[model samples]
Target: MDGMQGAAGTVRSGEVIKPAIAFESVHLDLGGREVLRDVSFSLPSGSFGCVIGPSGSGKTTVLRLAGGFLQAKNGSVCVGGVPRSGPSRDVAVVFQDYGRALLPWRDSYGNVSLALEAAGVPRSERKDRIERLLTTVGLGKHLHKYPSEMSGGMQQRLQIARCLAQEPRILLMDEPFGALDAMTRQTLQDELLRLVSDSGMTVLFVTHDLEEALYLGDVVVALAANPGRVDRVVTVPLPSPRSQLATREHSEFLRLRRELFGLMQDGHG
Candidate 1:
């Protein structure tokens, strides 16, 4: 989030985790319209950060640049300290459309194995890893179930398992929980926290929900819509081991919520 971040992130005891994702004066355009301008931010290693904005704020565009699906028209976008021009195995994306993200014909096991297959993993070494990933995502019992057989949450979980199969160092999630019911969304949020903590992976998540961003992020980056540029970068000071009930009810959370709400509405830093 900031220089030598500790306590909340993986860097500790004078250790410094370099920014896994750095966008320096990044500029992008599509179809003759400037989408982003002079955008700059860095996500510290093992940190969970969110990008929030209204429509046309370039939130998804930022994620796409980070994931190497797009490149900056000016300046630089780097992942794992290297300039991103294309996709890498070190980076994996989990999209908002869990339904379309998964293969309809592939069972849970088959879907999870897709990543390994793309990487040319041998058939012998695939089963144990796939099984472990499915279990981690709470899909062990549904290993053979097709995408159509699972609920929205389960489908999302399977997609995550498939992504994790890549053994990625950074996870780029674009509102991966937006489609689920409230109860299921909260459940997946907690599960994601646990998963990230255990894996110690750096995350750059994009969401329009302020509460969701605050709940999951070590830092929140707010963008203004016109020409899509950074408005503010809010560091989360809420205590670690964040709980849905306690953290949401905390004064800090409320204060930050108000702060971001005004920013989003006012379209200013």
Candidate 2:
């Protein structure tokens, strides 16, 4: 309860602030099917927000909208107070499918270097930056390994390293750890928390696991499908840095889980 704190609603005294990401009554239609309906929420700077609900609840769509990969038909999605037009260097995404997200042809080092290349970092500077990024994600020794040779967790870590190479201010993660086993998933969850804390990056994570959402989020936003919309937004009051066992056993965590489970059940019914 005392290592680090979730910054969801905290503001320093006398500090006027704006949300890092804001969705204003947003509406979206994909292939004539409404995916999101009048959805709205705000993530404070440097806070971790988790989006959760029943399957097909537009959780990934919301992340995509925030990342500027998709546009809303009505209302607005803004980052740093500006309307999102398209993909920006300041934002990076970590997708659930690391196998697809990573380039199998490239080694770990080369994969991370791709970001630097896209950013136009000179050839001379790419080595140190790429090495640092891969090392930061615990891929230091596996730098020469291709995606096909790495384990699922390692590939996901490499994907994250590639994202970090962009030096993004905002990170959009769509179930990035869903494919891993429980232990690997928890390990990556903690790693992600540490990385975000160190970098002060605003994160919007989408996950179907209730415990995973509660464990990583500063605020949990529940959406209801059949035209996904915000059904509830609960601020996590638990202290950080959270532990896999202890935090999960915390009274508040259990309470929120029960509440979210009911909401999700209602959403599906």
Candidate 3:
């Protein structure tokens, strides 16, 4: 495999780590129906790539493949150069349904701490990191609160906090904010942008919302439904510390969004 230079000059495995995630000639089939066909792309390390398409277009399937949840029937799915066969320990997933994902018995802090315990981080350091992660996600006050005790927004934050404990190389998010209210979803999107920037983790996000994908992804990938294949890829050119107001008003932002919307619509048709 030839290595391609990633952004920031980081060397991904196989000599190039620029694209932290890559799917080469990949295919998937379930129940005699082809889910994805010949899908391919590269997401650089420390960058964000969001998958967009119509419902049942295999957007989630791509993330699952990258996370090792679904295996590619053919081709290679690699993270940092190594081929992925099953779920890689270096990857962490945050799903849309935070309530169902988190253990009901555990409080916010406990949920995050469980991951740390598995990682063998010392108790003292684990405590410190958990606090930091929770605080970073704006959940410091809810540290002791259980899922039932917190709002939908806060519980999603807890899921993110737990994923942070492992400090995964790639963070795979599957419509994490889709179930939240509009206001809450916006707030979480802001927090997630900051989190990805600060943590320097490669992110592969799955979403059906073009606006959301535009807001979060360094590159937005649109997949066609029914065969779930890559239709187009658009790179986001917004400046850092992207504020909602400034980003929405930026010329390039609007351009990219319009372009992405067209691409998505094209895929749908």
Candidate 4:
């Protein structure tokens, strides 16, 4: 928890604020099979946390539990110091498959507007909010285009724009960039970091890529499968506003990448 001191909580004079998300010895069973066991971690308010592990390590399940889409068989998942009983508007999720997440018939503007409508925002207020959200995700000019008409990256950006419309306090992403090409993935990664930083929203992102986890996370939590559980937590000391090139080239980044790679390899073997 060395590097976690500053990122996990607000330190004023000397006290640490409560974490924005907390998993307390959480356990889960899915389809009669044990998925997560005794998993625990905490993300401080406005910090970015990444979960990386081999396939079937319950990475997505962790995100689902955090979002209240699934319940833990034992233990608790808490947000803002309260045990989550169900999904709250304060939390939003972005999935890997943008094609399915978005409506093929709706244009980017309509898609983002749906969230505002659901949130009960008035018609007069919805336009500006939707426009701003879409622009924030770099979809300003693509407003009238349908999901089917846009590229994979644009669709994903639209999905994120819709989520941002929720004004969420926590963003849960499940391998959101896994489907994009390398160039597009890196661009979206930087965009996501900027949006999260500016909005002061906490994020819990799950990915199979070790380097990605290190690049975007303030803390990287590695889970081991076969009754998935927290294996280790590494504090990423990389400076904020990380660059795709310079940050990856940093000695600490390389060091942590190697460390995490070994951890994952060992878990698999």
The best candidate by lDDT is 2
Question: Regarding TM-score, does 1 or 2 come out ahead?
Answer: 2
Worst 10 residues of 4 by lDDT: 7-16
lDDT (10s digit) by residue, model 1, range 9-91: 65343235447999999998899999999999998889999999988899999999999999888999988778998999989
lDDT of 2: 0.92
What candidate 3 gets wrong by more than 4 Å, as runs, is 1-14, 266-269
TM-scores vs. true structure, each candidate: 0.92, 0.93, 0.91, 0.93
Model 4, position 190, has a per-residue lDDT of: 96
Across 34-122, the per-residue lDDT of candidate 4 in tens digits comes to 99999999999999999999987899999999999898879999898878889999999999999999988889999999888889999
Which has the higher lDDT value, candidate number 3 or candidate number 4?
Answer: 4
Indicate the TM-score of model 4.
0.93
What is candidate 2's TM-score against the reference?
0.93
**lDDT for every model?**
0.92, 0.92, 0.87, 0.91
- With candidate 4 superimposed using the best TM-score fit, by how many Å does residue 22's alpha carbon deviate from the native? 0.2
Candidate 4, clashing residue pairs? 8-44
Q: Clash totals for all models, in order?
A: 0, 2, 6, 1
lDDT of 4 at 64: 92
